[model samples]
Target: MRRHTLSTAVTLCFAASLAAAASAPSEARPASPPASQTARQQARVPVLVDCFFHPEVRPTDFVLACGDGNSRLTSLHWSRWGQASAKAVGVNIVNDCKPYCAAGRFHSYPVVVRLDRAQPWKKRPHLQHYSRMTLEYPAGRPDTFPPTVTYPLWN
Candidate 1:
């Protein structure tokens, strides 16, 4: 009976320790940035750029969020990583285009993406400093568009 009690206690303690380790936060998690309005610096700012779609074949369309607002689109790029990492974000709106409409202007918009060399580079609300974005667009009307994209680092 004494042996049984000792084993049970040890088992309980081990389980508790494992649980604590599982929930602990690590260095990979950075702190959030402060709001500074003096400069055009973006608090939750993403590296953004507008690109034109040059189609070699006919034109195709994808979904997107766009307008005169922040989450809007005007022109599009394929994502520097191409169709494979498109989910990490390949295209975005180009406001430079006057009137904001033209052939191959894209319709299906994917969410924002972080184009980190690492797969699934999710954005953390607490991250400080700027993260780089890789912009890609439909070049040559090329016969491809990424089927998936990641979020936060859209260009």
Candidate 2:
């Protein structure tokens, strides 16, 4: 009888503590924002759109060849990413295509990447995206490529 009473008392105490905790307001809860602040927060910044139409900022890797897996940029370290332009240093991996594209070997070359000419994205007028890309090979480059090359980026 003593054990049964003691167990009942403990259970009742536990239930009361839980109820008190449930009624207490949380101190870590964030306060609601004003209407103007919410609108300002929703405003989009300039970005680089990938082949898949995804907006990216300071991406570590990006595809240069969207049609075939021939070329790409990897190990990117962006020094600047602003409304007008962005710059980075990375490796440009290209396929040699010695025998043929199917039997090609990939090679890596150090490159300096720059993106500029920001304009309103065609798909999303409210957002801006870079429209041009220039790559400069500091040390060595592919046999067919020059020291620098500029290409129009897809919107």
Candidate 3:
């Protein structure tokens, strides 16, 4: 008789639990955004592609002269990196080539770097890259360079 009472009580408790669960509200899930909105959010920022085709953002050092390492940017501090443009301040190290290309002294000049004209990268169409780079020397520029110069970055 005791065993029968205990079994009845256990079954009652189990049935009550099921009933409570059936009446409970379902857990809510966040609604997903529209496909267009998701795509826009996922759009990648423009990057500076290195000579080896590696993308870089806020690089401390970058080689402007990929072939001979004659000119480069060092100690870069980027102020802005946006969809349309990017800006930075760094030192432009230029090889003077006083005697010849093989034997030249590198000179440092204070410069403001601006990257603009963003377009879809040919190598990675889903992403964008800065196509143009303009360098403005604030003071003591390299002898071979003007106060301001612009170059078309390789795609």
Model 1 lDDT, full chain set = 0.33
Error of 1 at 33 (Å): 22
- List TM-score per model, in order: 0.21, 0.72, 0.72
Least well predicted 10-residue stretch by lDDT in candidate 3: 21-30
On residues 55-78, what C-alpha lDDT tens digit does candidate 3 reach at each position?
Answer: 677789888987666788999999
lDDT over C-alpha atoms for residue 94 of model 3: 86
* Model 3: CA > 4 A from native: 1-42
Candidate 1 residue 75 Cα shift, in angstroms, is 14
What clash count does candidate 1 reach?
37
lDDT of 1 at 113: 41
Q: Candidate 2: misplaced stretches above 4 Å?
A: 1-44
TM-score of 1: 0.21
Ranking by lDDT: 3, 2, 1
Q: What digit string (tens of lDDT, one per residue) describes model 1 on residues 4-70?
A: 5554555455446545544657553444334354123432322222222111111122223322221
Candidate 1 vs candidate 2, lDDT winner: 2
Which window of 10 residues has the lowest lDDT sum in candidate 2? 36-45
